[model samples]
Target chain A: MGKLKLAVGVAGALAVGVASLSALAAENIRIGLIEPLSGPIAAIGSEALDNFNHAADRVNARGGVLGGRKLEIIGLDNAMKAEKTTEQLKKAVDMGLSYVIQGVGSNHALNIIKFLDKHNKRNPGKEIVFLNHSAVTTAFTNELCSFWHFRFDANVDMKVAALVTQISRDPGVEKLYLLNQNYAYGKSFQAAANKLLKERATDVELVGDELIVPFGKVLDFTPYIAKIKASGADTVLTGNWGPDLHRFVKGAVDSGLGATFYTVYGGIPSSIGGYGDAGKKVNLKQVTEMHENQDGLPEDLRDYMKSYIEAYESTWYPDRYRWLIEQLAAAIDAAGTADPIPVAGKLEGMTFPGPLGEVKMRADDHQMQMPLVVSTLTSDVPKHLIYKGKDFGIGFKTDGVVERADTTLPTSCQMDRPG
Target chain B: MEVFAFSLFNGILYGMLLFMLASGLTLIFSMMGVLNFAHASFFMLGAYLAYQISAYVGFWPGLVVAPLIVGVIGAAVERWGLRPVHKFGHVAELLFTFGLAFVIEEVVQLIWGKVPMPYDIPASMNFAAFSWQGLDYSAYRLFMLVISVAIFAALFLFIAKTRIGLIIQAALTQPNIVSALGHDVPRIFMWTFGFGCALAGLAGVIGGNVLGTEPAMAITLGPIVFVVIVIGGLGSLWGALVAALFIGIVDNLAISYDLSFYPLFAVFGVERDVTGIMQDLVRLTTASIAPVLPYFLLVLILIVRPRGLFGTRDV
Candidate 1:
């Protein structure tokens, strides 16, 4: 009789211990970050991840979300491959992480959305939500849209619309040349530029529209530069990223091609070094969300930038990931649960204050509407703290900013929502 | 006419650089029946080492010291890495070098982040060397041309005239006989491999800034080096030279022109509502197809002459 009583007491104690451990686990929410942590573009992923972690720290410091439940980020290296990304997504699901963030490649984004849709259909109550901080392909929020996928960054059409507005304002750009990589993103960029140029800047002649090289294949761009010079193009508009952008700018400088490079990715690190002193002499412009030394930025953003630079030793770009997490936290709080379906529903058409100003996640499409800033690289240094170019060891000075009101383009998305 | 002249000049300069890289690989492959797949990786190492060294002691000293450092690394790789793999045969040796290439790239990324290093032309050489038809040619490119030509002449004399060169030549033909003559054949092999890598290092020292020294530099230039060797008649130095120049010039000329197939189709009087894959083919231009020219040439050459243009033996 005494032995039976002791056994009952031990069993009751074990049940209590398990229940308390689970409650402790429930106090924290895990968000998975799938990115290329290793490979050729690891630096890009590392910087983005650093920004994500910094954003998480800031959120947690501000008492987190859903009444102080701390947020934890789980990063998995997908190596920028689709197969590896799917595998990591599965792992994230198995770990009970309902929210996953991915950026970088649109191909990977499209694959993840398809994978998630299929997985959610099979698993019912275990549906996962995908938050895209970058990868601006239109199809993600357009024809290929999913109920579970939400993109925080502007799509290609929106960026093109903003870029065209900037280009039209400059009367010096009479002849424009379009050079881009031959891929989905590049094709979209070309198509949008063509349509937008015709609509907005009809006076500007399209001198050359060439998609001559594959991504990351062209080492020498002298031939291309020669063509541009021969065409007498006053402005060269390109959407090429990575080494392609750097090499093209370098070739232009080397060949003395006297054209303003109005590019989407001209401000990335090491690109300024490619221009050398030529950048100071040439017209180099880029479209971004935020830059250092903007006169009227909010105090909170300034403080955030200071802390981020102090920790990472690099300047932080206005990443949508920060705003996405804040918005996600607010949505979770509104829903009063960590379950993805309800939280995702709450996230639709959500409005939150971002670094630049107020940002809204469109209900029609899951695309975020935020401000775009058009800036130029000048010889002058910024008055405020800034991220210096790693290669050139010089800070980028901005010339202008286009507010969200002026840059946001109307979305053509007709989303098919999940009942 | 100006564009044609400029393209030709640029092509010749580019070809000479390719020759400098390929000459070493051809000699190494002939000497030790092992194709060093990591040859371009050593080239990349040379560039990165030069960049680091240049930060402390100016560019001129970096040029000298960096190649020597690469040579030592190459010799060590031969003694420790390649020598052991030789017993397992050529495939094992090739795979070993292939894996070494990846390891070197990862190490480069770890030491220097993935961004392109600020390996620019020295300030003194930044000005234009000359002007042709109102176009300014960079002084540094001219300097690169002179260095490549000088190295070629020096390498030619060293291999054709020196006593060590004669021994190396003999060993290429009869390794066992040369070893029997009180010569340490393995040490000679190690020295030859190191010398070959040093040549590649020299190419990198010059080519790095022009080509942009990043982690992907090895993979970018690796295949072209192999193509040069194969087309030049794998074991022959002169053959490699001719092939490299040919490829470089042809590639440049192809890129310089933008001839569309649509015009060709019109000339042939085959004008119909082109659709599907046919339409895509019709829209193709010379500039779009230029990157593949060298590979196309390689295939054609292989089919026509399996031994290559100047090859004395089968590759």
Candidate 2:
């Protein structure tokens, strides 16, 4: 009887330990959000946070993920700097967040990718997955494609390619001046456009091209605008967004060059609201249609975006950026599990119904190669007009778009595969 | 001729604005021997204040009230923030101001958030200022030029004529002697700092309409202000003026030209790519020069003539 009692005690203790472990492990999905919250890009960062949190709340309201498992979001501010991103990403790993939804910028994303790959290789069993919402460089999804990494934004090449193809047909644009932000993404856009222009439009005259400093200094545009006007170029194509564009445009107009036509990238909410009228008056051809915004898709598929936008007035409400986050979340859901390794595998050729339209993350490069919407700015609208202008009829070339099959993953990224 | 004329006109107009920000910076540094990194932040604050004020009271009242408030704030900063850090040396003072800049930026964001304010040109200045060469120039920009020049003239007269100005100039020239003369040297320093800040605040008010009142405006404008000061040298108002104009002209000219021109390598049959490596090179070279030109010029001038153009002494 004594031996039997001892045996029963040992069994009970094992059962209690198992019960505790099970309770500890019970359905908690932690998704990490890395953005530049405290730095110069904090505005954009805060917006991203608002967007992600809103989506997370919506997802949680609909019974969480994977059958009643509560989804939790962990936010880490990388200050939009590369070194800081690496440090914060390590902190996320330490916090035991297996999945991450990151912000824009290639350098920051690259840093996280390096850390995740190394950590996963070393630990083997505990894999961390990174779902990128901000970094638009093709490398995250291309040759440097990690099984643990997935990208949501359309790459630099695709965005510029779509705009350039449509702009090339304009007869008035005999000569063009190119101004871009000086960085990897900017350089890539310039490079990609050059390649496409060479392959296609031979008549386009290359006038003065220049790159602005990254996180550019406040500059007087008299000289630059004068140069553009003097170059006798009919049109200008620039790859700068936000405050820089605002300053540049005002300065350009001030310098007596308002008549000179130009195209700028990275449309923001404020600019859209205020200058949408100006853009329409000047007939700015902006790219808006092809992303993951719900309005860009069919009626049945747009309910997710429509609901989110209706609830959140200014954040994800029919915007390009909100669509990006939604697509990323949907991709995680499509994999049936938010584990980066399996989810990243399922990301390829995944058709996610986003706020913009139906987007497919290509299997080859892992970039979402959706149709690019060419919009013109109109002065009459309350919001910055994307498609209304004198040249409204010539929308972005939806047909000439490079299919996902044409884009190869970047050749530069060489990573060791996981066993 | 039309393009050159237009560019020159643009260069001068831009130069005047640069002078407004740069002159204030140069004066403060001349008076205190401390590069106020927070100067641009004050300018940004001025813009925000004007935006808020103009919404309630008209633009002209905002113009007056913003600078006065900024001046008072600057005086407070000098008394509390910079004075404590001054004993630690100039570098420490600069670092303190840098920290102040960081804080001010965050505070601005906290107050205004990240969105750009709708601070449009006033109805009075909305029409064309003047037109030449088939181009319609904005009245607001013209107004900016007029106001900047007026401020410059007023500043010149004040420094040349007033008793406080004389003391400040003496401090810039001979701090020890000025102290020996019993001018309450620290008080003069405080007033000068406040005055410089007021000028920057005024610039911000006018600038906000042209450059949209946004939190990040300071960061974008900060380095260029420094560039203007450094190129102007540390303690000379005149040098600052010349450097600012030079920068304005060079920046405008650089962006207006083709990027394929290598002063050294014109021999290579450089094929221009509209969107490729060459295109990117052009864009980078032309666009980045304005912000860095003053720095480059400063370094070159230091190497050739250490005191900067028309400067009294080495920084």
Candidate 3:
């Protein structure tokens, strides 16, 4: 009986000690990283998780944030559903986390924006700011713009502009056909292509434009390829990803459509590897911040790529995500507090030196104005970079970089700031 | 002329793939009076097994060995799993297979993970069989076409001409008579089910690279296989073949042609632009509706001809 009482006393003492340790650890600021971590596109979320963890480690190594308080990243899975996103945000709010980060889909981002707009309005002291790293729908910064929302990645308009610039560069690209998936992003891509093509390349004829059912629905793209062939278009522009892109491109190439494809995501992850020699036939170009074969890389960049490739077995696609963390940490440091309002103030109209070059956050819309690159898949990358896409012996060659100023466009945001 | 030729050619190729998959389902349903809901899962299993085997012994060996392994598995499933549930009515048997499908999918995920395997066309077959105009038709697809045709021919001969085939046909109507003649009836049922699954596994062996070998590959192709079998008249081989070709060609032709509803609306003579919500629906061309064409045809066939094109029993 005496021994049992002593044991109970020791266990209570241990529990209290652990509780006090957690109280000390509670001084760290938490950023809820809400993403689709458990669905068909779970890899996208998990990849971002790795990059976010790396970014956090880099910050913590640099003497942490907010005068020695560490930046803690809390991962929350939304299962790629828009309705579930608010639930995750509410969970984050329940934990008293004042900052949340999300990327992957525009629908999820919009949900966060709507939920937070009401939550921040209703609850005065407990406001959470959303840091968007990759969802690039343009309206988020324009029509449905929120004061608390800051986008770190370039928008659809910016990417479309970059693609159009690539089209302008190639004098051979006379006839253009826009075939995309029939969805909001696809429609937006078509609109941007039409509007931008008319302005920039008046010589390029818009031959045909159609939208098919989005991914997994279309098992065969040969009929669509025939339609393109019949159009006599020299270039095909599509924003197709996943199986949709791979199959469409394969059909076009194999059937001898003889048209160059300018795409949004052509050579991105788990894609085009199965294309075999069909990948080599067409001039497939994609628009992004960076590719493996970008010329004149620094030693730091090369080592970083090597380490990332070794660790993840995937090409590091989202550089803007890293920048998002840097900018957030910088904002917190400058504000001298982890308060969402003050940090958001510091983040808006911020300019920082990213790895590639200087990128800015426009005060008017809180959209990142970063330079975009239009690259083509080629076998002529540097030897070190050859290991990246060695399966297909093809990687993106930097064709041209649309400057930050060129990529920037006017926004129509009318944010109602708190007095 | 070239556009029509290409679409027709591609349509026939797709139809052949469907026939390859559906013929097995037809055989199993005809012989056993059981619809194997987990048939497509066997296809997926074959692909993953082939992929794993190919990594060790090369593609050609994997192609031969994987389907055989799948046949063994199918036989085991019939003997162990299905035989016990055979005493139950059709609905109970169906529920068993339905549950089996989910279990198989989970097991595949547990083993292979939920990503697409890097199973691709063999290097020897990766080149274009021929190039016409500017496009290169893959040699692998032609190989697939040849294998599909061969499978149909072999299955037809084995079922129609062979002595075992005669016994099996007789047993379909007179299981007691066939058993009285000293033939083991349950063993024949087991073999037929195994052979049926083997055909599906073979289809996977060839179709995996084309359709993509992933966990969702089964589910994606699952509904379409039913559409084929249903429209073909369930348990009718010839009917399945014809229906598959019909669906494949119609789907291809719909996508190939850019016909719109504007002309359809013009015939009414009270012509006005479709506005508001109707605008998007009106603008939807044949290409946009191609995805649901097969299902639409299935519904049409069910409403118009419930027995299917050549089905003996009403679906």
Candidate 4:
């Protein structure tokens, strides 16, 4: 009986310890990092989680954000699917998440944005803040841009417009052929590009623009390439990235196609790093969703990146949008309160030093404005052919890239404002 | 002209792949009258197991061993799992198979993390055999074509020539009589199930590198096989072959062609390249049409001729 009493006492003590830890974690700004950890984009999702963890560690080590309140990150794997994302978003909200760090693509973001809008409407004072790290769909800010949702990366429109302006500036470029992934981003970007180019560049003939699957849907791109060649277009503008870009570029080269000027719309830092020296010959220019080199960024962001890199090493460093994660953490911090409602207020028109330059959320829309860098491949060779860093100019800094009426916009301001 | 030729070639290749998957499904359905939803999962299992085996040994060894292993497992499933469920009617059997597919998918996830297995084409089949006009097609696809054809020929011979084959054919028509004659009906059913699963497994072994050895591959491939079986007419092997090839060819051709007839309606743009809202409509139409060509064709055939092309039975 005495031994049993002692055992119960120990169990009570352990439970108290755990409760204290939870309390302490709650005391810190509890940010939610909801991403597809195990699904199709597991590689990107897990990496984003690690980066977020590193940034949180740094913030906590400095005695936490907002008066030593420490940053506690709770991660949930949405698995990059529509059903799983809704479940995870609900779970995150239930867990009292102040902010959510989402993945890079717009399709996933579109689902989350819709969910948040409904959630915000249901709970008037209690709103959930969405700190999007990688959702680059301009529609997020344009039409469906919620006050609660804050983007860290450049949207498709900005990235494309930047590329178009860059291409137009170049005297060698006469014609442009737009090749995009056959999904939402592809459709939206293609439409936007066609519309913008028609309005802007009258001299440049819009050659045969086509949509192909992002990855290896077609092993041979010969037909598409042949069409481009036939169109008399000297330059091919594409939005393919990561493994798809690598595979497509390699496939094109293997087919004995000559080195053509290529403009890829979205590239992550590591993908840029991977484009070693060999990319120089192809005239490959990369315009990414996020900034690559943090050293060139603002002081606050550079320091955050340094600390994050120190904490997580190169595995979760700039290679996987560490700055994007930092920007999300900052937005969560700016909310002051732990609840998502207050955090969401800090997100709208919230300007913070991001890894790129300045992350300013437009008051008219919730899309964050960040610089999209257009860099050329250097002599990094076959290894970093997709992500080489030689021709990286500060490039174009887009202002007001996201239009309010494009994606997600509340019918009126009276609908709901972040508390 | 070149586009048509290549499209036709692509169709044939795709058809052979479909045959590999559909033949197994047809055999299972025809013999047992149980629509085995887990057949595609078995095909996926074959691919993953082959990938693992090929990683250690060579592709050839994996190809030979994986199907046999899958066949054994399939036979075991029939004896241990499905046989008991058979008393619960065809719907229950189908639900059981559907549940099996779900369980298999989870098991696959547990075994191999929810990511595509890095199963690349073996170094031997990595290089292009030849370039047609200017385009270079993978030699592995050619290998897939030959093996599938050989398997089809072998299956044809076995069903037509062998005494057991004759017994099986007779059993399909008059099952009660064949059973009353005391010819071990259960064993024949088991063997047919095993044989069908083996064909699916063989396809997986070849298709793993081509289509990727991922859990989602089964879900992606499962419906197409059903389409093939339904379009081919349930009890006919020749029907399956023709339907599979026809569907495959039509799909490839549809995707290749730019489906834009906007000139008939719109005055602003008369472009052939399908884009905007039309692009989405075309994509949905193309995707839906690609997998269901056999079903559509089958329906048309059913309306005119109750028995499918080369099919003896009304099914």
Candidate 5:
């Protein structure tokens, strides 16, 4: 009789445990962050993860999303390879995850879009939505637009337009030169620069244009700088990032070639390490979403940036991520279901508050329309910024903010909506 | 005319830097008969050590202290790691040094992480020393050129004039005879290997100041150093200098040219089309293929003269 009573009590306890476990699982929404978490670019992946986690925390702290259900971000390492990305996507699907976020490489982005298009068609009611945070290829939305994909960052054309606006305003930029990495993105950049300059700043003369291999190939850029100097180009525009950009700028400074450099990736504080004082006279300008050292930044946003810098020790993260999460939560709440199909429908043509005011996702192309800021790397900031245990004594100052309407570009995205 | 002069100037400066790195490899390969694959890693290690020491003390002390540390580590490797493997054969020594290179790079990455350290030119030497045709040559570069020449002269005098240098030269060819002279032949060999590594470390101290001091830098410079020694000939120190300068000038001139293969093909009456790989090759520019020009010169030399110019004998 004692054994029977003991067995019965144990079974009852086990039944209660099983019931709560199911309830707990149902109360959480898992979004897969498929990115390179282990490889050369792992630091970038983990930094993006931390930012996303903080965004989720902020959303959850605000009474949770979808009637108090928690948001869970599950990282799946792709090792920065395309094949591994496809495998991670399959794992996410098999695990019943409906949404995955990836943005480091456009190759991986294209892989996810093509994989999901077939997978969704083969198996109805199991659709996955791709939320892109930073892959900025213009053709992704314009030519290969997908109904299931939503991009939060501005594309190349919009960025070029913003830079050209600043160029037209500057009387010093009379002779323009274009130097870019010889690849698809670089070719697009050259095209965009030429097209936009013709349209916006026709007075600026293009004196020299050249393309070179990306990185690891060019050990010294002095020869190239000499050519630029010989061309008598007073202003130079380049789409080079990483070593290519920094080394060229360093060579220019060492050569004392006093031409202004308008670049794509010079705004990042970490990339321009040890180059602050040297780069001061070069008139380095970059186009981006926002800068910390604006003339009249709002107190709340300033406090927010201060807190983030205190946590991360560097300001290399893009601000569009926080905006991405806040907008996502709003879309989920409005849809009243965590299913990606209905949630994506709600996300299209959505508008929410951002650091720079109203941010929108255009229904035609699923591209986010937001205000872009053109900033110059300078020692003379309106406000001094200290970060990473060193008094930087330098910050990116706001040249001006291109309004959202001005940032919006026309798209050719024709989509097939679901029934 | 100005472009040509400027490019030539830049080429000579680059060639001298290459010689700074290639001289160490030449000593090891020619004197020791042991291909030290981890040579560039020693250079990398020297740069990293300098950066660390410079953070504590000033740059000047680190410049001395870092190379000493690197030399000590290299000597220990000769005593413990390479000496045992040396009896196995030349292939074993090659494989051992190759493995050592990988180990050093991994250890560097483990400690330093992936981001580049702020190892930059010292502010005291960061001014334009001269200007020609409105283009300034930096003081730091002048310092580099002086150091390279000084190193070349010192190495040349030490090997050609010093008593120990004579003994070393004798030991390489007459190891048994020198061993009979009541001297420690093994110890001399160990020190010679260490000295070769120290030269690389010294090169790293200056090279990292301008090029960069990262894990990938060793790999980037490793192949070019081998090119210098091979083209210089198997055992010629002077040959290394001449070959390095040749490659450097040719590389710079190649990069300065914007001319394409179009003109060459048009002269041959081969009209370019858009469809084929041959057509694309025809459209390729000289500046785009400048990185491969060194190897092209190497192959051309090997085909015409396998022994190499000024080299006493082939390896």
Candidate 6:
């Protein structure tokens, strides 16, 4: 009788342990962040990761999706290479991570989308959904759009459209020079700029259109600056990012090229610190989703920025990833399962209150329609600047904000849905 | 005329900087019979060290001290890293340096966090040297020209006139004979390697501000330095100088001009609607081809004159 009682007690304890372990497993959803964690743009990747984690923490605090299942983010470094990104994606899948987020390079995103589509086809139940936070390539949503890939940030056309609207209004910009990196994204930027300029600002002359340097290769832009000055361009438009952007701005300042720079990525953190005082001199206009101290910003966003800046001593662009995650969580809850296919199905046409404003994930192409802000860099820090952690006396001053209604662009994507 | 003058000046300045880097690499390659692939990494290290040193000391002191620190590190690397692998032959030495380059980049990223340092021109030298045709020539660039020229003159005189230089020259030609003598040949090799690295470091100190001091700076300038030495002549210092300047000037001129392949095709009466590769070929401009010009020159020189312009021996 004593032996039987001891066996029964042990069995009960084992059963309880198994039950708790299963419960713990059910209470967490894992997401993988595959990005360039160690390269020229590692800083950008790190900042984005920090913001995502901060958003995850907030969600978990408010009782995570699907009846308090905590959101977990696992970061994997892609090293800014497509091959490495594919390897990371495979690794993430092997680790049972169904949801993956990547940005930085459009080529990487396109390749990963192809990889995921192939993988999903092979393994039907185990599908990985990619949430692209930053890569603004139009081809990702148009010609190469995958059911597996959903982009939260505005595409090149949308951002360029908003920029064109602002440029058309500005009487100062007469002669414009277009300088871009030689790549798919850069080519798209150039095409969009040409199309937008024809429609919006016909008076402005296209002085020079040059595809100057390969991405992450150029060390000096003085020669390029000399060409821009010689072109007699009053304004310059470029989609160059990372060191290319920083170096170009510095070269312009050093050479005393008085042309105003209108860029898609002028407000990167490295540019602010790298350009120093020269950054303040150039009329650097950037089309972004968010900037500190913009009027009519929601209080919740202000609080989120405050907490994020205080926790992580860096600034993040297009905090749309946070909203993307929120919608992802809602979709999971709505689907009643953590399966990627179901979650992806539920995410289509999902509307969520984003930091900028209300954002909708269009079912047709999986592109998020959200507000875009065009701002200029100034040395003046406003009193309402909630995200100022340690400003080098450079901050973005809001010029104009294009609403989500104005940011919608036609997509040629015919997404093949899973049965 | 102003554009021509400006491009020429900028090219010469860029060439002088290249020469500073290539001179050391040429010296090491000629003496050690080992291509120091990590030579540009040492240049990158110099910039980072200068940035760190400049934070504590002024830029002047940083400029003086950083190269010295780099020289010491180079000597240590020669004594420890390269000397052990030297017996494995040229391939081994090359592989070691190549591996060292990757290691150095990783270590640099760990320390510097992958973002460029605020290594700008000194405030005193920030003003324009002159203005012509509504363009202001940077005073800092002219300062670089003066410094590099001084270094070249000093190096030329030291190598030509000094007894130690004569010993180094003799050792380069007949290492076994020099080793048989009372003088320590390996010690000379070590010192020469250190000195070569120091020259690269000095180049880095000046080039960092202009090029932007980041981890990728080494990779950006490394291959170009090799091109300079190869095109000029592998072992000839004068050859390296001439090749660097020539390449630099041609590169700048090519970039400054916007001549397209479309015009050439039009001249040949090829008015057909082009698509695919042909369309891309037609759209190609001199500016687009500028970056590849050095490599093009390298290939052409190799095919035509394998010994290079002034090379006494084939590399």
Query: What tens-digit string does per-residue lDDT give for candidate 3 at A1-419?
Result: 99999999999999999999777555888889998776556656766787788778768877788667788788999978877888898899899999999988888898889999999999999999999988878899999999989999888888998889878988889889998888888888888889999988888999898898886778778777766776789899888877777777766765667788898878665565545456767788888877666765555556666767776565666778777888899999999888899999999999977555688999889999888888887776753222233455667778788888778788999988865
Q: How accurate locally is residue B175 in candidate 1, as Cα lDDT from 0 to 100? A: 81
- Candidate 1 docks at the CAPRI level of medium
Worst 10 residues of 6 chain B by lDDT: B269-278
Q: Highest DockQ: give the candidate number.
A: 6
**Per-residue lDDT of candidate 5, residues A1-419 (tens digit):** 99999999999999999999768645778899998886545656776887788778767776778768888899999988888999999999999999899888777888998998888888889999999998878888988998888999988888888888888888899888899887777778888989989988999999988888776557677778878887899999998876677677877888888899888778665455535346565678998877776555556556667667777666634778877888789989999888899899999999976667788999999999988888887878764444345555667877778888777888988887777
Tell me each candidate's TM-score. Answer: 0.93, 0.86, 0.90, 0.76, 0.89, 0.94
Q: TM-score rank, highest first?
A: 6, 1, 3, 5, 2, 4
- First chain TM-score for all predictions: 0.91, 0.80, 0.89, 0.77, 0.90, 0.92
TM-score of candidate 2 versus the correct structure, residues matched by position? 0.86
The alpha-carbon lDDT assigned to residue B303 of candidate 3 equals: 99
Candidate 4's displacement at residue A192, Å, is: 2.5
User: Which parts of model 1 have CA positions greater than 4 angstroms off?
Assistant: A1-26, A273-282, A383-393, A403-406, A410-412, B263-276
Q: What is each predicted model's overall lDDT from 0 to 1?
A: 0.80, 0.68, 0.81, 0.65, 0.81, 0.82
Residue A144's lDDT within candidate 3 is 93
Q: Residue B254 of model 2: what lDDT?
A: 59
lDDT (10s digit) by residue, model 2, range B1-315: 766666677778878888887777887887778789998999989998998898798789999999999999998999998888877998998899899888888888888776676676676776776776545577877888888888878877788788887888888668789999887877888888898899889989988777667767888788777767767777677777778788887766655543434433334655444455566443344546556666787778878877777777786
Q: lDDT per residue, candidate 2, A345-419, as tens digits?
A: 666677765433456766655556555555444334323212111111112212233334333233344444455
Off by over 4 Å in 3: A1-26, A274-277, A296-303, A383-392, B1-6, B106-115, B131-134, B166-186, B267-274
Model 1 C-alpha lDDT per residue in residues A1-419, reported as the tens digit of each score: 99999999999999999999778655789999999999867777777788888898998998887667888888889988889999999899899889999988998888889999898988988889999988899888777888889999888877877777788888788999999887789889999999999988888899999885665467578677877877889899988876678777766777677788888878766566555555556678888777765667778788988888788777767557778888888898899888899999999999977656788898887888887766777656654223333424344555455567765666667666666
Q: What are the per-residue Cα lDDT tens digits for candidate 5 across B231-305? A: 888667898899888877877888787678788878877777746767657768888777677888778778888
Model 6 TM: 0.94
Model 6, range B23-96, lDDT digits (tens) per residue? 78888876666789998998988888888887787689988998999898888889999889888888998999
Model 5 misplaced stretches (Cα beyond 4 Å):
A1-28, A36-41, A78-96, A111-127, A274-277, A295-300, A382-387, A416-419, B87-91, B160-163, B166-186, B234-236, B267-283, B298-315
Best lDDT goes to which candidate? Answer: 6
